[model samples]
Target: MSVTGTASDIASSESVPTSFGEFQPVGHVMVGLPTQGNVDALIDALHEAGWPPESLLRFTPGQSVEELQALVEGAGPLAGFGYEITLLRRYLELARNGYRWLLVKVDGTDEAAAAVQHARACHATLAVHYRRLVVEELL
Candidate 1:
């Protein structure tokens, strides 16, 4: 879950998020779009946010290819924005397998203010980024 490389690597991306310093991967992301319209919004938003394809992990309990693809498309708006967002799902093996908490594991260097700002932007109540954690909802 730790994608630690170099700063040069992040800066080199073509279309990068302005919140460059905030760029960091966390545990995982769980999204279930029950409708096509919702999927479109997510896709459009993700595209504008600059999400790296390799950074995402997906799962669908019982969804068709088309349905999954639509959700994937929308996920683009949420990636590489310097935030690692993971979802804990019910009825999933990982959840029952004892992976209850999605720990925000960091592997980089960044400022506190920057981290908090990134969390706010993502509307994340508990956020961990770039080796620094601004919120701890687990408490």
Candidate 2:
């Protein structure tokens, strides 16, 4: 039998260890997070390290494709902050549950490092964000 609920509930449930223990990681881990004032701190850190504020883009899955495309293309010279059409489609499907997403592109490891540091400073938890982001999609 199968049971379902919000990702947080599923993830935190006692049954998860038994039910999902068979799963294994397929590759190295990468992480992402959302923040409050932490976003400003991250932006500042990135900019100090040479990644401009324009290097980040925010999108919600409910947006139309045309609207998404226009927003990406309309960035004009600021386009290609490493965004891909496929990412939009993936997020569109993944983020239907009122989760806002931020895409970050850093020119170097230093910027990436700073971003993570800022996220940690803001107490961002990717797992919780992931849960909120996918609650509707899973149901």
Instruction: Please name the candidate that would achieve the greatest TM-score relative to the true structure.
Output: 2
- List TM-scores for all candidates, in order: 0.27, 0.35
Query: lDDT per model, in order?
Result: 0.30, 0.34
Per-residue lDDT of candidate 1, residues 1-139 (tens digit): 2222211111122222213433233332223333333333433344344434343222222323333233233444545242232321121333233221111222333333333343344333333333234423221
lDDT of 2 by residue, 28-123 (tens): 111223433443454455456454444544332333233344433443343344233333344334344333334454434444455555555544
- Displacement of the residue 58 alpha carbon in candidate 2, Å: 1.6
Q: Which stretches of model 2 miss by more than 4 angstroms?
A: 1-50, 60-94, 127-139
The lowest-lDDT stretch of 10 consecutive residues in candidate 2 is 2-11
